[model samples]
Target: MVGRPLPLRDLGFRSTMELVAEMPKVVRVCPNGKGSVVLKGEA
Candidate 1:
């Protein structure tokens, strides 16, 4: 029998923050006037 590796969805806070910080800069805007900016990336 062959074993497959498990996929990791969440990397927790430390790793997640690091990844977010290293991500490319993007222009985020609130079109609905929600006063919140969101990161835009490839779908």
Candidate 2:
């Protein structure tokens, strides 16, 4: 979703998995900001 850890934590998400659990529509996460896919959505 986002490229920074602070933003994710600020959103009340303990981890990427936690955020993914809440947002099923999130297809992937680009944490490195280099256009890489960090995590893939299960939903």
Candidate 3:
């Protein structure tokens, strides 16, 4: 949340693991979760 919001389009062609690895320490991704992960906020 300290920087500009990452647009969904920027995530295109990237793998989930790639995104997860690039995420900040405060961001958590649950690859095993039952439902899709939702990103809440304006971009």
Best by TM-score: 2
Worst 10 residues of 3 by lDDT: 34-43
lDDT of 2 by residue, 1-43 (tens): 4764556678888876677767657665547778655776557
Those runs of model 1 whose alpha carbons end farther than 4 Å from true positions after fitting are 1-15, 25-37
Q: Residues 1-43, candidate 1, lDDT per residue (tens digit)? A: 2594323245433553355555556433324568655656633
| Tens-place lDDT digits, model 3, residues 1-43 | 4697645457673565566556656456554576676433333
Off by over 4 Å in 2: 1-3, 28-43
List where candidate 3 sits over 4 angstroms from the true fold. 1-9, 27-43
lDDT against the true structure, per candidate, is 0.47, 0.67, 0.55
Model 1 root-mean-square deviation: 8.1
Give the lDDT of residue 29 in candidate 3. 53
**How many steric overlaps does candidate 1 have?**
0
Ranking by lDDT: 2, 3, 1
Estimated TM-score for each candidate: 0.26, 0.41, 0.29
RMSD values for the candidates in order, in angstroms, are 8.1, 7.3, 7.7
